[model samples]
Target: MTSKARLIYNPVSGREQMPKNVADILDVLEQAGYEASAFRTTPEKMSAQNEATRAAKEGFDLIVAAGGDGTINEVVNGIAFLEDRPKMAIIPAGTTNDYARALGIPRDNIPDAAKIILKNKTRKMDIGKACFNKKTQYFVNIAASGSLTELTYGVPYEIKSALGYAAYLIKGAEMLPHLTENEMRLTYDDGVYEGKLSMFLLGMTNSIGGFEQIMPDAQLSDGLFQLIVVKPSDPGNLLKLMALALNGKHVDDPNIIYTKTRSLKAELIGKSEGKDLPVNLDGEIGGYCPVSFDNLKQHIEFYVGC
Candidate 1:
């Protein structure tokens, strides 16, 4: 039986040169014996999740996402709802292919990635579900609250286009001076902790913001979620933590606290009591603080090169 490959790609990703690579990808897939078809994504059209869901329902053997983290998030969301999901692949066609990096997919070359996808070694990985208000969804990587969340919301779309991943650093630096500490009460399977914290990040994957290693101990298939909490500290301590994170050494830093849990609940406890502090899920800001996270064990499967 010939495997069918459906590609959902963002045309505007990767310096607007992503479409240029499609023909080559199609050629490679065809050579590998896949009945390949490509679809261009638009803002108003069916989302990546919708596309993936449709493909899986229509019995595509493989569904490939060819954008960045946001695109992968959608595709994962689509597959999460399927009873029998198709093996998913990544083409790493975005500016910061964070999910691709976490999966050890090569971004510099396209043909190699296509070849790997054709081979199709599927691995079952844990999925994280975040619920706030009436919105509840699944994330394959990190869900964060506080400063990083605010930064994600505050950064303009234009800046993201102009600077790529560096836009996050610039926006984060600018917001640092004015960032407010979050007074939150956190409850997890292990225990409960309450305090004023600079930021709270829960990771199912090792990295965040494309390159920052916020959760150095995170494993995608570990079946547990890793939580990193940054307490309210002196600016110097925060700076040191930031530096350590860039080097993937934040787990060892004294000021940063790391823990693993199957589930966690965060409630805001202060003057901004009723107000919702922005919470970022997989680099997209939408939910508020006081969010609950639960691990969905082996909930999703991916075609990984590693």
Candidate 2:
């Protein structure tokens, strides 16, 4: 019996071109001897996770996400804790496609990816779980805090849709002058430390927004997350740090501190004086500090190119 494959598509992703490509993907999958269907996603009624759960219950052998990082995030959350999870596949139709990038999925070709999915080769990969207050979720990419997070939140959606990754640089320059360091108390599996930090980034994958800005040595299957901390210092030093990150050389700088850990907890130490500190998870604003992260090792299965 032929196995079923369901494609969850977000119409608004990647300059609003995902829907058409999803149609093409469904046709390709059907030609490859798989029972295929495409579902249009919406913020209100249906979600990628909802679709994945429904498909899994209906006995789908493969669940493919045909959109951006956020779309993949929703799908992963659906299958992460299931007893008999369906194999996951991706068709890179997003701006960054960060998770697909980490898995060696082809960015330019969709038909080829569909063929690989039909082959059914799989690999188990780690997923990171983050908690904020009463909410808990998993992310397959980086979780960041501080100035960069603020910039990510402040950037206009129009600008993001227009310039893509370049929007970050444009917004980061505007927010740099007003950015201030915050006091944080962080504890990991190794130890605890308190300090004024300019930035804190926990990387489960090598890149953020499809750019290798921080944590150059991060690996997805390594069973550890890379923690990078920028100490509070002069504004000039912070500028230098930014320049180094653009070239992917910040990890070698003496002022930056890097470590590998399985879990970490960070708490805001000092009063913000009515200022709201922003934190970002996979490009979405995830609340303030006082958040904790635990590594969910080999929690999700992925399809990778041979």
Candidate 3:
């Protein structure tokens, strides 16, 4: 029997060339013996999830998420809950394809990416399930929260479309002076840590927001997340830590807390009492904090190149 492939792509993601390349991508899959079809995501929230779920139910042999982290996260959440899920593929057609980079997938090369998909090598990977504000959502890469980190959502659509990832850096630099420490109580695996922190990042993969060294030790199938918490410090000190993080050496700093764990809980305290800490998942605004995360070990089988 011929295998069915469902291609779900975000038309405007990254360079917005997927619409033009759809024919080529489909042709590649067809040449590789797949009965391929494509689905362009709608403007509605969770539309990718809905489409992915429908594809899963209909039993597509392979489900392709052709966009950035947000689109991949949506597709993961869409089909993760099902006991019968299909093999997954990704096309890194986004401004910052951090997840793809970590997996050694070609980001700027479309035909090469399609060729990699045809290779069909796959691995079992972990998935993160976060419960916040009485709602549960899933993530494939990283989940983060802190001051200045919320700027990913503030970059105007026009700016993002025109300047791509540089827009994030420009906005981040502009918001540096506004960085606020988050006072919180965090519990992870039989230990409690309370402090005023600059940022808290939970990661399942080494590459985060295009920074490969941010969580260099993270392993996708490890069933544990690499957590990094930056303690409250002066702006200069914070800048130094940021620089060190670029080389994955920030863990040696006294103000930096790093560990690997299966679960964690974060609660707001001190200055964060009445405010909701903005949370980001896979480069998109997830929600507010007062959240908990659990790793679903080897939850999904994802295809990648050899």
The root-mean-square deviation over C-alpha atoms between each candidate and the true structure, in angstroms, is 2.3, 2.4, 1.8
Candidate 3 C-alpha lDDT tens digits along 195-269: 888788899998876677889788889899998888888777776776686799988899988999999898899
Q: Tens-digit lDDT track for model 1 on 1-306?
A: 898988888887766666888888888778767899988888974478788888889998877888877788888887876788877778886666777788878877766776776675778889898888787878888888876566555667678767877887777677677767777899987888788888888888776766647777778887799988887777666666667778778777766779999999999897657866878877787577678888988877777878
Q: Candidate 2: where is the Cα deviation over 4 Å?
A: 31-33, 118-120, 272-276
Worst 10 residues of 3 by lDDT: 148-157
Extract clashing residue pairs from model 3.
none
1 or 3: which has the higher lDDT? 3
> Sorted by lDDT, highest first, which candidate order results?
3, 1, 2
Q: Flag clash pairs in model 2.
A: none
Which stretch of 10 consecutive residues in model 2 shows the poorest summed lDDT? 270-279
The C-alpha TM-scores of every prediction are 0.90, 0.89, 0.94
The lDDT values for all models are 0.78, 0.77, 0.84
**Which residue runs of candidate 3 sit more than 4 Å off their true CA positions?**
156-169
lDDT of 3 at 215: 90
Candidate 1's error at 265, in angstroms?
1.4
